[model samples]
Target: MVTLKLLLAISTIKQWHTLQIDINNAFLNGDLNEEVYMSLPKGLTVSLSSCADPPLVCKLHKSIYGLKQSSRQWYTTLSDALLSAGFKQSQADYTLFTKGQDDQFIALLVYVDDIIIAGPNLKLLHQLQHSLHARFKLKALGTLKYFLGFEIARSERGLFISQRQYTINLLEDTGYLGSKPAKTPMDPKLKLDNIQGEPLADPSQYRRLIGRLLYLTLSRPDITYSVHTLSQFMSAPRTTHLQAVHHLLRFLKGSPGQGLLYSSTSSLHLRAFSDSDWAACPLTRRSTTGFCVFIGDCLISWRTKKQPTISKSSAEAEYRALAATASELTWLQYILADLHIHSSTPAFIYCDNLSAVHIANNPTFHERTKHIELDCHFIRDKIKAGSIRLIPVRSSLQLADAFTKALSSTSLNSHISKMTVHDIHRPS
Candidate 1:
């Protein structure tokens, strides 16, 4: 998903033509190396069978849909074809293939059989499409508008991606289409725990709901934290969890078409915001790490996850968040390099915790920071290598705060607006 968003953002910034392609019978294209036998069909009567011959089995020579190795073999076959066409596979992302550079640059991202081809040159894209068609049947969908349930709207301003239909379907299926609307996905004052209520009678519904909500977060970052919080109780979801899910659905009903906008006027430079909520989890006492990465003004990546280890202090939690943010930025830098977008300036990372900032810049470790010594070294290395610069920000101005914890309606709206989330289907 990060790679997909990055590709779209780059294409938007470059004003390139982004097209989609599908491989017909993609799994059947792979050549099987191992010897495998299959039973003959029940209805087929061979000539030998009429002669009272022994029961016969068919030897498989090619990959098939039900085979476990089909997907891998198909990817191998496709990679070989792309490589033969002078396209270099990205080490940062194996699914991404690039050919040429600058004005002649063309990038192809493959998600199983579906593909997205982006570049400024239409002739080259068409040529590549034709080439792929010769190797394997291709269904070229000109001008990418939808892929993997994401509805994209392209314009001079940029690309607007949403899952309006997806959200509506979820609401309709859950019988929440006409439910009372919610001002926010989760209540700011609410603290959910595992032992809050009796176990649900049927947990599969809750699990399925969480799974769908997880995919919905692809375009709706506003619900990410809430979804992340609810996902933890998938195994033994209770009545209270279901109630919370209902609230989240009501929130979705309010603005089903809300999504992110990748702006064309945005710069190519990178910046990020890192934040953490110390001891946010009442049961585990673990902190939640949140971060958002941007290419100029366009947000390409963000994450909301709980820390693996419990932090003794708020500074340690904040520092851990900073380290995680640095790791994501490093990967984004590599991805940018693969996309031929280079930058010498170090990416700026804003943290509202002053102690965390000092801990990152100051190498000297004290008794309070010894437990997180490794985190300190990791953050300092990025700082010394000029990969990222840590900046102090006020708590009110922290964009990542929304991700780390539930926020008030006003605060959530303010943060979501800054993240470029909008409802395009609403009255203008």
Candidate 2:
């Protein structure tokens, strides 16, 4: 359900008209496989001793909404119906179904029982409704104003997808609704280190805090570094680490309405930025790898993870970052090809390290890079094959740097602004 909702949230930015509909009594339509029985309700069988035998149990002939397998059963019923109607399920994404007749096409995306129908056929969409209503109790919701978490709006200029309500609720839940705002999520001067010291009072509370901050990444990438740093101490959190998490909540208080803004544009370029910190972790010498993927100006995917293997040098750490970026770009290219949206422009991968770029373009097997030769060769191969081109982007221009380490308030603001996340305000 979350996956389907996220797709609609993203496609809204493309200015495509949307329609949301829900199946009434969705679970009751499914056929039951076994003879399931439930105890009678409290009102029923008022006098248990009055009955000759035990009180009769209500036998379930069809699936109900609250059953464990109810959703999956209803999904199967819907899939069979769509398949019989000549719609083909997308191999890449199961929730997506497509039907086309020459120039006319219709795409149906389903979130459990709620669905959004889009294509070039309003007439056919109405026809589809008549047929669907006959099979199951369904209501056609007028032009979507809000679907899932995003509050949607469309005008002559473009479409707007925002989660203003969600953000406000987050602030209230974290007790940041009445707190003073911090200029930045974290202070650069404060270096977080795990000394040989005692852990916090309650480890579970620290974990709960980290979990919420992770979800905030949906709209606030600025807090990505602070959250990433605090996650390392989940098993045994210290007082200092908990303090850092609290500071981030204060930051969230300031920008409760922020969310990613995907402007309507027509460019098919796959660009990415790769960055890594060299031996930054105090406990372990492992560096963090971070990258962000963009489709034209749309921010689609980003990741921040600790390197799997320890690198002997900074060059090796940077090389691992490139390979991670390549994997993401490859998946993205495949997804585009499936959608018939091929990029005419070549994809560019921006890396901060000069040695990594040289290792990608150069064939020399230096002894220093021998240990990670196989990993280093992927970039060299991709560069030679023209799948990706490595360009030198100045360190200051690197957005992924925000994910690698804590930065000064000025640098934090700069990178956060570059992300282009807008404040999701209510309609005036």
Candidate 3:
């Protein structure tokens, strides 16, 4: 999904036309490499008149749906075909393939059977489509309206991607279609702990809900923090945790049509914001790291995860968060380079902690800082190489603050607005 969004954002910047293709019975196209046999079914038995004891098995020559290696085999076949067609596979993302150069370039992103082909030249895209169809049966979806449950709408302004139908179906499945809407996904004052409440009667239900919510975060960044918080309790969910999930569902009910808008007018510059909630986990006393990356004004990537190691100081936690953000920025830079878009200016990474900013720039390391030396060096290397610049921003203006912790309704809306997260169905 991160790669998909990045492609869409770059395509929007280039004003490229995107097309979709679905391979029919995509798995069956792969030729079997090893000799494999399958037992014949009860009704489909071979005649035994020609032999004393006829074999009740058949040798498989092609990949099938139930085969364990079907996906890998299909991918190998597809990769071979694309490689033969002059497309270079991306090291950053194996599923991505690119050909041509400059204005005549074409990019193809593969997700199992579904593919998205984007380029500025319509003739080249059609030629590629015909070529792919000749190799394997393909159903051209045409003009990239929907793929992988995301509904895409393009206009003169830009592209709008949403999961409106998916959200509605989820609400209906959970019996929350007519439920009252929630102003916020989670209560700002709530502190969820593992030891306080009794386990739910059915842990599987809580796990399933969390799984769906995690997918929902793909298009809804506002619920990311709440979903991350609720996901922690999936193993032994209590009534309180289930209630929190219910709250998130109600929040989704309020605006099921809300989604991301990728604007053509947005610039191509890269910037990111990093923040942390020091010792936020009640169970392990570990801090939570949150960061968001932007390509021009569009938010391309964001994450909220609890740190694996406990930091002794707030600066250590913030520094670790900055390191994570820097890693994502480095990968984004590589992706942009693959697209032939070079960043003339260094990416600006905003941090709320001044000590962390200093730690990234400072070469001196003490005994207390030795544990985080790896992270410090990684961030400093990027800084010294002029790939990124760490700047301290006021906590009030920190866009990643909402990702680290639950925020008040006012503050949450403020940050969402700044992130360009809006309901496309709302009146302009």
Candidate 4:
């Protein structure tokens, strides 16, 4: 998803043309490296001279859909073909391949059989598509309108990507289409625990619901926190958890068309916000870490997860959150460099905790910080190297605050707006 966002960002910046293609019988194109045999079909018309006494089965020479090794074999074949075409595969993302440099550059992103090709040169892009068609059976999709369930709309302003169809189907499947719309996905005062209610008779249903919701989060950042909270009870879901899921479904019913928008007018500057909810979990008392990264005004990446260990203080928890954010920023830097987009200014990281910022800038370790793991000190090195600078902001202005914990309806909407999440299909 990060690669997809970067590709869109670069395309928007350069006003490049984008195309999509689908491979027909993709798995069957792979040539088998090992000998494998299968039984003959129901009807056999082989000559007696060619058949053994017991009749010999058929040997397979090509890949098949059901074979466990089919995907690997297909990937190997595709990678070899691209490499032979003077395209270099990205070390950070093997699925991404690039050719040429600067304005002449073209990129191809592969997701199994579906591929997205984008570049500044239209003629070269079409020529490469023809080349790929010659090697394999390709179905040309003139423009990249839809891929992997995401409906993409491109205009002079920018690109709008949504999953309205997917969300509608999910709502219909879960029987929430006719339900009342919810103002908020989750109640701020609601508290969920492992043993709060009776165990569900069939936990698989709950698991399935959670799985579908997980995929919806790809484009809908508004439900990220609520979904993350409900996902924790997947192992042993209770009645309360099921109710919470229904509440989320109601929220989706209100605005199923919401999605992410990438503005062409936005700048290319990188900034991030890091935050944590100290001891948010009632069962394990583990802190939840949340961070969101933006390239200019567009939100590219975000995460919400629980801490691996218990923190003695809120500053420690915040510092750990900063470490995670720094790691993501470092990877983003590498990706931007690969895309030939360099930033002269250092990336800025915002946190509401002053102590955490002090800890990152401080050279000497205090007695209270002796037990801190060496891995948590990664942000310090990044700060010293001038790769990223940490700044303290007020808690109310923190965009990641909604990710770490449930917020009031007003606060949630405020953060959502700041993150640039809304329904582009709707009127202003």
lDDT of 1 by residue, 271-332 (tens): 99999999989889999999998888888899999999999999899999999999999898
TM-score of decoy 3: 0.94
What is the total number of backbone clashes in candidate 3? 0
Question: For residues 1-428, what per-residue lDDT tens digits would candidate 2 score against the true structure?
Answer: 32333344345544445577887754465433434445565566555687777646564556787889888877888899999999988776788777875335666888887788865456777777788888887889967776666676665434555566776786787777899988888887777777644688778888987886777675567777788888888888888888888788888777776766666552457788999999888778898999887776666677788997788889889889998898778767765554445666667899989988888778777777777848547777777778889999999999889888888889877886776556646243
- Evaluated against the true structure, the overall lDDT of model 2 is 0.74
**Alpha carbon lDDT of each predicted model:** 0.90, 0.74, 0.89, 0.88
Question: Could you estimate the TM-score for every candidate?
Answer: 0.94, 0.81, 0.94, 0.93
Q: lDDT, candidate 3, residue 205?
A: 91
Query: Candidate 1: what lDDT?
Result: 0.90
Which candidate tops lDDT? 1
Q: What's the residue-level lDDT of 273 in candidate 2?
A: 91
Query: Which 10-residue window of candidate 2 scores lowest in summed lDDT?
Result: 1-10
In model 3, the Cα lDDT at residue 192 comes to 94
Taking all chains together, the TM-score of candidate 2 against the true structure is 0.81
